[model samples]
Target chain A: MQELKDEVKKLLEQGSIAGFLGMIATTSGVVPHLFVADKADEIEKLTTGDVRYSLVQILRWIAVRHPDDKFGIMCRACDERAMTEMFRNSQLSMDKVVMLGIPCTDELRIACECEEPTPKSLLFGQSTAKKWDKADVERIDAMETEERLDWWTEQLGKCIKCYGCRNSCPMCFCRVCTLNDDPLVKRGEIPSEFPSFHLTRAFHMAGRCVDCGLCEEACPMDIPIRTIYRKVRLVVGELTNFWTGESKGKSPLAELGDGTFPIQ
Target chain B: MADESGSPFEPKIVAFCCNWCTYAGADLAGGMRLKYEPNFVTVRVMCSARVSPHFIIRAFQEGADGVFIGGCHIGDCHYVKGNYITAKRVAIMKRLLEFLGIPKERLHLVWIAASEGDKYAREVDAFTEKVRAMGPSPLKQVRFWKDATVSKKIYKSEAAAETPAGA
Candidate 1:
């Protein structure tokens, strides 16, 4: 923790970054904060813990508003992947931002069912080798067609039309979201019409979703949204051999390629 | 066409066909009088890639039991690689639909050349039979406007009653 604060303070003092985006442990709880250079002394308030916030989303907001300013973020493995996907999607410029990667705690690793808990660069915390459990995805895959439909419908029925999943996603940077599109999603509905809202989002997330698990975390209804997206990722991988945020090139869906899907 | 019961389930399938390939194949099928299922209501686009995932979702939402996408064969796309994009989009869409409990078979993507009229007719027949067994889309059963209409009626009456008071 001391090393992280010192690094951030040094960057601030050196005028290397306009602001350092990290989590601050307040009395209310852990919240994301932008520690600026002027108040480098307050870097002591910065802390890395079990609580996860969408810091990359905050970085995008800050970067777009302050395009001229160079920013740094306290990023996790998922955050790094999210940033990579966002950069691939033209949402952020990698050259303008610096990533101060942090390894996730054991509690966070288990809770998130994270495939990779530590970022490429380990700046703070111990990097633990945590393997993700694919039992949930496999369980759904084993269900009968009708049973799977019933399970998803019942699960998605709890969606109060809250866009927390979209709002929390770091890769979701569209100016006008299709989830809010009246013609597509139909406004003024609680559940937003079954299968349409969720299915549309899953399809859109096909090659774009980084499997960050933020969308699932932000869902008030606990829809297991990440599972749906995992299936999407599998499809994208099977069809194009491309995983989101894994490649520097654009998604196959976004670009023309010689590769063909094995459609019988 | 109505069956013996006068209302046998006939799946309403929406087929998005590329103008350069599948659309011309359908025209040739028409010219040859090749028999194909009437379930397919075709929407011709310039290229298969033009049919976005939104269109497929919207088709199901608006009561399409299944969606069929047809494009030129690989390396034969009029736009060079438009069909490749279509293939990727459809593959992802199919996987997503399957995850959502909608059978992946509900969405079909095929490569049809302009000259393959018989193949187009056979593919449509096969897809129609497959979708017919799957039943109507679950989305079609959802009453999207039920609450909206009820609320609209209430608001209209309240506004009508307030007219005299306001004046």
Candidate 2:
């Protein structure tokens, strides 16, 4: 932890970056903080908190105001993957960004079922990559058709229509969300009409979801929102042979490709 | 659930046709006097890709037992890649549908050219029958109907005569 703090401090002092973005321990818990040269002492509290925050989301916000400024971003493997896609999506400039990857503890990796827990620029810990069990997706897949329908109906019916899932999603960056659009989901409905609300979100996540788990964690209704997204991700992964949020390339869904998208 | 008279279930179908091809194809089906099931309502859009995933979901929510999308044959889209995008969207939409418990078959996507009036008639009839066998969409049971106020009321005077205003 001191090494990380010192490294960030060194980056700040040397003016390699105008500021560093990482988690800061707060009275309640850990939250995102911007470590700058002017506030050099603040680097002491720089830590990868016990909980996950979308560091890239914050980075995007900061970059919008300070577009030309180079910034050091502390990232987990998931954060790094998310960041990579953001760059690919033109949400951030790669040259303006420096990543200090924090390899997740094996315990955290296993708990998240994270396939790759080591970012390209590893600051610490051993590289660990393994497949997620996908038990949740498979369990739902195994259900009888009627049973599956009932299961999803009950699960999605619990939605309070809080944009919590979208708000927490690293991939959901659209300033004007389709969820709020009329004729898609009516304005001011509590249980945002069954299936469309959730399914629309899953469809949008098709080729883009990074399996970050933040949306699932943010759901107050405990909807298995990530499970649906994982289905789309796996579908896209199998079809395009491109899993998003990993190594780079524009998502095929993001454009009308050379007309040879494999459609079965 | 059946009607009050308990008639056989007739599945309501919503078909989205691309303006350049399938919509024209449907017109040809009529010109040729090709008889197909009258179970479908065709909504024409500028292109097949214009049918957003939510449109299909909204179709189901509005009580369509089946949602069919017909676009120009792959390479023949008037916009060049609109149908191609439609294909990709349908692929994604189908997966999400299956995961949400709707049988993937309930949502059908096909590439039919403007010259393929016979194909249009045949495919729609086939899909209509397929949906009939599947019975009502499980989603139809949700019965989420949207009501809009009518600007003109036909029975205002009659309603007042039938009952006291307070009553």
Candidate 3:
């Protein structure tokens, strides 16, 4: 933990980055903070807690406002994947940012049900084993079509339309969201019109959702939103052989080319 | 559209057809007098890629029992590779629909040429029957229209009750 603080302090002293985005241990809990170069002493308060936030989204907010400045961010594997996806989408430029990758702890790894708990370039901590169980996906797949429909209706019926999932997702950077579009998601409708609201979101997450599980955590209703997105990821994989943020490559859905997606 | 007892269920379908291919094929079908279901409402676009996923979702939300997207063949797109993107979008949209428990068969993507008038008629007939079998969209069962009507009534009564007796 001290090593991380010292590393950021050195980067700050050398003027390598205008600001560093990381979590700070507050009296209540850990919260995201941007430590500027002049206030290097604040690095002491920085903490790597089990709690996760959309630091990549925060980076986007910072980058768009200050395009000329170089920024550094503490990234988990999912955060790195989100960054790569945003970069591929031309939402952010990798050249203007530095990633300080932090490996997830064992507790966090299990809690998140993560496959890859460590970033590609790890600056600190030990990498945990991958947990790729798809019991939730399999459980839904096993149900009859009618039963599945009823199940989803019941599950999605609990939605309060808070948009917490979208707000917390690092990959959802669209300025004008389709969720707010009056035609797609009707205005002032609680639970927001069955499958359209949820399915639209799931479809948009196709080649972009990096299995961050943040959406599920942020949901007030505890909807297994990530499971739905996991299925989407699988479908995208089967259809286009593209995994979200598996490589620093563009999304297959973003561009059109001959024979890239042969009609089956 | 009526049956023995009452009006039979005629499923509403939304078809998005590319101007260069499917729309022309549909026009040809009309010229040939090829009988097809009248339930389908066609929206013409320049390219298949113009039919965004939101359009399809909106169609379903607006009470469409099925959505039909027709584009030119992969190598024959008027806009070079418009159909290619369409294929990817449809594939993902179909999977998403299935995941959400909406029958995957409710959404259909077909390659139709301007010359294939008979094929266009046949495909429309088949899709209409499939949607008919699927019955009303699950969204309809939720009674969104009823909610809107009820809310409007409540607002009207509230306004009337608040009005001054002299006025």
Candidate 4:
């Protein structure tokens, strides 16, 4: 925490960034908000808590409209990974930005089942655990085909099409989302089409989902939304020899050229 | 083959064709009067790259029994690398569909150049037979639709009740 404060102090003193993006204590809970910490004194106001929101969405809005200004972001495990994936997908810029990496604590790390809880640069805290639960994926995979289909259909049928899941995801930054497109997703309906609207979004996130779990958290119906994307992530890794945010220079499998690596 | 209801199992398929190659090839097949199944509804886009995996999935949920995507040959994309992306995308989507227990034969990816009119006919004829054998998709199944409608009503009321007055 002390180190992060010092880093923020330096960035503010140097005037390297137009604004600092992080969480501010809200009346309800902690939520992401942009802070222009131009002076050293404002650094005291910044706080990092358990509450999370879609910070990447904010970064995306500012990055597109104001390309000239630089921005500094305080990113944790999933947040940094998400931002990295967003950068690869052309949603965020790496050049006009500074990343203040904070490692996840053991408690938070296990709750998220994060694979990489540390970033390249450490702004605060020491690295903890990297817990991954394959049980959820395995359980779904173990179901009979008919049972699986029925289960998915039943779960998807509970949707009210609030789109809270999509809105909360940092990687879901498409200005013209296909889910809203009439022919593709069938707009103006309750309980959007099963295995189509959600599965399509999941498939699109195959090599791009950073496993942030924001989509599941945002779903009002409490659908196991992360499981779908998590399976896609695994499937892409198995098929294409790539995982999102594992490396910087690698392109998304969906964007790969006509190169086939033998499915091992 | 006719069933008890006398319906011929005419499954609806959506074909995403790249404008430069596959779409022109389809037009060529039309000009040549080559007979193919009319079950397919063609959606022409600038490149097959524009056909996101979501579009194919949506087609199925919106009542398509199958999806066929045709693009320029690997090295011949008009956008230089667009069809390459399409190739990779289709390959991944095929695996995903199979993983979900959707029959692998229901979805097809082919490379058709502007001159492959006869090839286009053969592909469609083969795919039509394949889908015909698979029968109608779950969307057309009466039991599935009945359950879907009932579940949607339950969900609608639950959603309304959950979002209390400005809370």
Candidate 5:
């Protein structure tokens, strides 16, 4: 804790970042909050949550509005991945931001089965987890074609279309979404024109999702949103041999010019 | 096979054809006297890569019984590797569809050259049959027919309630 505090102090004292994007315990839940040295005292109450926060989204909001000022983020693997993917897509800039890595606890790790629970830099907390379980994705993979169809139909039927998943996602930074459009998503459906609304989000997140699991958490109907994203990630890994956030400023699979880039 | 209500299965297939190859292939099928199901509504795009997965899903959402992407075969793609990306996407999307409890067969990606008029005929025939057996898409049946009024009412009321932070 002291080490993390010291790093925060050093970062703030450097005057490089305009503010710090992290989280604090609110009465309702742990929510993302922006901390600046002018308000550095608030860093004392900064806390981590078993639940995830959209801290990157908050940083993105400030960064896009004020591109000249750099900011620091206390991000986990998912947050870093989200930021990295966004950066590749030109949504965020690494030049104007400093990353303060925060590793997830063993308890949080088990909850999400995160593979890279630790961040690349500015890491906080003890490393307690390794490896990720692919069973969640494989279970779907193992199902009979017909059975899988039935499963998704039933699951999609429960959708309330609250947009909670999209809203909570740190990487879903689109100014306009086709899912919300009346023509594409057929506005007014709760379960949301199955496959259309969810698949659109999933397809868009193909090279973009950071595997943050916030979408699943924020889903009111408890849809297995991560399953689709994970499958996309796996597909991307196979097709492009690239992982979002593993590198900085790398080109995305969709951007590969005519597949002659030798991605695989 | 008439039950209480006589409802003949007239499946709705949504075909996404690349403007360069398959769309023209479909046009060729029209030029020739190829007889196949007219169930398909063609959505033309410049390239197979331009067909986002959302478009296919949207077709399903909008009452499509089956969705098909007809593109040029791998090496023959006019845009070099456009079909390769389409192939990769189709592979993953088929898996996703199956996971969602929609039969994987409902979504198909076929490489039909502009000259393969007969292949287009066969694909449409097969797809139409497959969709016929699958019956109406569950999404089409539920979102369009059942609880639609209630769902629309809830969607509107909730959308209006969202206020951007600090607004």
Candidate 6:
């Protein structure tokens, strides 16, 4: 925590960054705050909080407001991944944003079953890369087709259509969400027409999700939305040998390609 | 056959056909007076890339036993490479179906050129029979999808059951 604060302070003092975005310890709790040069005291409050706030979402919000400003922000593996994917999509200019990578603790790695716990740009703390466990997807896949159908149907039945998952997702950057579109997802419906609603979201996350597990955390109904998306991440890997955030540029799904995937 | 209705179950298949190829091929099949299965309906779109994954998912939710996407051969799309994206999306969509425990076979992608009307007719018949063998979709018998309607119906039923004549 001290090292993080010192790094931010140095960047702020040098006028390299307009502000440093990170978690600030407060009476309420550790909340995401922007620390600038004038108010250097706030940098003292900067601490690596345990909670997984949508830091990328916050960065995008501020970046859009101040397009010309060069900003520094803290990032975990998922946050960094989301930012890179966002940069590739032209949502934010890469040169203007500097990342201070936060390494995930061993406990966090296990808890999130995080695919890649350490970000690309690490400045503080010792970090190690861990392989993602496919326990959830494998368990679900082990069941018979009918049994699996029942399991998912029950899971899908729990959705209240609160849109919590979409709201929490860092990759969900669409100005006009198709989930609310009339013809696609249908308006004024609850339990949201089963497989269609959930599958639509899963389809949209094809090459975008970095296995952040935020959607699963935000689901009020306790729906395992991550399993479907994790499956998507795996499929994207299998089909095109592409992993989100590992590289920059357009997702292969959007590109014109030679027909390699067999038509079944 | 032993059920009260006493009629064989018929599966419903929704096929999205690209206008530049598969749609025209279906037209050729029609012009040649070829007989195909009646279970599947072809929806015409300008390009197979236009068939969003949402359309397939919605078809399944609405009780379609099978969803088919018929696009032009690779490098032969009307818009030049539309089928490339269609192929990729369909492959990914299949994984999503399997992840949800739905049989991946329920969704299929096939390339049918404008000249291959006979092949289109043959593939449709095969797909229809395959879906029929799989029987009615599990999603077909869902009673209510609207939460508000279900809740209101529950309220009314409880009210009626509690006070027979509102006495």
Q: Model 4: what is its DockQ? A: 0.28
| Cα lDDT of model 4 by residue, A240-261, tens digit | 6688877657665645555443
lDDT tens string, model 5, B1-167?
22236868788888899988898888888889899888999889888888887777767767788998888876788888787777767777776666676777888888889998888988999989888887877565446325656445324434567866567
Chain A alone, TM-score for each of the models? Answer: 0.95, 0.94, 0.95, 0.91, 0.90, 0.94
Cα RMSD of predicted structure 4 = 5.7
Give each model's clash number: 0, 0, 0, 0, 6, 0
TM-score quality measure for candidate 2: 0.91
* lDDT of each residue in A185-234, candidate 1, tens digit only: 87767655767888888887877888888898899877888898888877
- Index of the highest-lDDT prediction: 3
**Interface DockQ per candidate:** 0.33, 0.31, 0.31, 0.28, 0.27, 0.47
- Candidate 1 runs further than 4 Å off: B1-7, B135-167
lDDT of each: 0.82, 0.83, 0.84, 0.77, 0.75, 0.83
lDDT of 2 by residue, B53-107 (tens): 8889889887889999988887899998887788788887887788788989999
Q: Is candidate 3 or candidate 5 better by DockQ?
A: 3
- Name the weakest run of 10 consecutive residues (lDDT summed) in model 4 chain A: A255-264
Off by over 4 Å in 6: A105-110, A127-131, A259-261, B1-4, B146-167
In model 6, chain B matches the true chain B with a TM-score of 0.84
lDDT of 3 by residue, A1-264 (tens): 677788889888899899999999889999999999878778989987889999999989999999999998998888988888888988889888888888786668667777677788678777674677888888998888777776776667677889999999999998899889885677667745766788889988988899999999999987788899999998898887888888546677776655467654
Per-residue lDDT of B4-111 in model 6, one digit per residue for the tens?
487787778999999999999999999999999988877999999999888898888887889999999987888987787888888888888887878899998999
lDDT over C-alpha atoms for residue A161 of model 3? 89
- Of 4 and 6, the candidate ahead on DockQ is 6
Give the better candidate number (1 or 6) by lDDT. 6
In Å, residue B145's CA in model 1 sits off its true spot by: 7.5
User: Among all windows of ten consecutive residues in candidate 3 chain A, which has the lowest summed lDDT?
Assistant: A255-264
Which candidate order results from sorting by TM-score in descending order?
A: 6, 2, 3, 1, 5, 4
